[model samples]
Target: MGRKLLSLLLFASLATATPAAAAPTAAPQPPTELVTGLSLPWATSFLPDGQSALMTERNSFRVSRVTLDGTRTTVGTVPNSVTTNGEGGLMGIAVSPTWNGTSDQAVYLFHTSTDGGQTQNRVVRMDFDGTTLSNRTVIVSGIRSNTFHNGGQLKFGPDGFLYAGTGDAQDTSTSQNDSSLNGKILRFTTSGQPAPGNPFGTLVYSKGHRNPQGLAWDSAGRMWSAELGDTQFDELNLIVSGHNYGWPICQGSCSTPGMDNPKRTWTTAEASPSSLAIVDDTAYVAALRGQRLWRVELNGENAGATQAYFTNTFGRLRSIVQVPGASAIWISTSNTNGDKLLRSVIQ
Candidate 1:
């Protein structure tokens, strides 16, 4: 899509978004270890049956099928994945919401790889048949990647489209560039084309992000994101299509017009939030530096005060997703030293 045309379409979509409605909130119980002896597990997406979930290991590039009862099986390693030696590697997996054992068995993944030996990030599709993965096909590719800030988080929104958060690839310029895919939240079709009705004619749903890693939707279908900041602050944002989140221009909150401020902000020491999950209208953020789970209640398009859970008890919390059929959540450790998956009940 041409930059000028894309810009016009993006702004057009912006004016069409409606305000979000709030949902209920709850407190989560202390987490208990479910699966141990894992590597750097980065993301988790449960199968439609709710009996098991598919998880990704960053440095190892291994995909594992983990049962609700803690049984873990190595499904397959993603092909051509490479670690950036900092943060880039195999990351983000989303099981198709309509996946069935027989036919509609699509699953998606986001990872760092080399295309013609040039480092980039990609979104790929594979088929899972309750046992193994096959038919690997690159759905979306050519997003710039670096050692760190290669934003890698994928989730299927309630609208039935795949959403991916891409980092600025350490190039601050890319976040503000409408033509670049980096530093943006992108919407895509099952076949990897830009999703229809996207604000931009391209895949970009929103731009000007630093390193957005967490993506989730509330009961009202409002999109929210958790982003890692450069030095001072981290952010939780209520995502609106075609919005521009201040990045290099503004870290947390600024008075700048045309740049949206975060709904909530935290000091880097308190929250290097890597992943987010929404349950009962409450936002649960997995903190990497603070080593805890931070909860923020959703109040319509705004957020409430923050609370911390299991502080310093878990080492470098990474992924957190609500259990498919229960009022519980599954979390993963990212320390890479015999990490584990945990489950927590919400009350």
Candidate 2:
């Protein structure tokens, strides 16, 4: 990598006025490993104080705590979770925006569970007492699940509502069905009811997702999602209420009526995106199969040219969370023996 910066200009349309220009920022420092020996850690939710973080491990159902100095401990476990090989078990986790570790100390989780022995994915909330978990509550249930395509990504949007991305349980038809909870982004109140002002009067916020895994709201409050396509193109979509994302009908972009196109896309081999984090107006996506981190600069809702780092240096990047109060991000790798937590500086 060169230290010299190159100026890049982008325009939305040919008829647009003088284009806005963005110069290449300085290359970031190589990531520093924070912890090791994690078993398929899926998502990372940082504590507001920034000294520690929570990590969820798939197939293990254990929530581990990672401190700034690389200490690790099993803080809690999601009970009744059913493990799956390809894509199941405990998945996304989030810290409640209002949690203060005292009166409202709560953490949220998304996992595949067989509470009824019928097999399904569900969302639950657990009380985090800063060292261990207690007081489990099933907030949402009955979302479809399968060995694959069980999209599990959770985050609280700027509106303070919990938003989750769910898969169609390998049933492509469900992506287009409004009545189905699968293949949709769901919005709910803090207690897990359908949020007010929902476009469909239900939990479904948007539809037509083929294993969408990543969600982040930009600085302007616009929501964005990173979607997985079947053996073709993966997409970064601008999510809006009640919009259809064209899953089975269209892979990338299409002119089909009543279907929305992606703002950007990448080949499946290059970017099987899993989790997204935004910092300094740039969206950083963690890729599982692609084994890299992708940075896409955001100009309002539009995405600029894409850049990738640590292409094969790290094996199967899974989750990334921006460290609060700093220009650094905590990252997790997916390789079995090689799984480790890393901190990469943002530049």
Question: Of the candidates shown, which would achieve the greatest lDDT relative to the real structure?
Answer: 1
Q: Score residue 113 of candidate 1 by CA lDDT.
A: 82
TM-score of every model versus the real structure: 0.92, 0.92
lDDT of 2 by residue, 38-132 (tens): 87889988777888888899988999988878799999898889976779889999998877789888899999998867778999999998899
Off by over 4 Å in 1: 1-25
TM-score: model 2 vs. ground truth: 0.92
Which residue pairs collide in model 2, if any? none
Residue 69 lDDT in candidate 1: 90
Clashing pairs in 1: 151-167
Which lDDT tens digits does candidate 1 get at residues 1-347?
Answer: 99999999998777565333343446889888999998889999999889999999999999999899989999998888999999999999999999996788898999998767877899999888888888888899989989899999999999999999999999999999999999999999999888999998899999989999999999899999999999999999999999999988999999889999999999999999999999888899999998999999899999997899999898899999988879999999988888999999998
User: Cα miss at 90, model 2 (Å)?
Assistant: 0.2
Clash counts for the predictions, in order? 1, 0
Residue 274 accuracy (lDDT) in model 1: 94
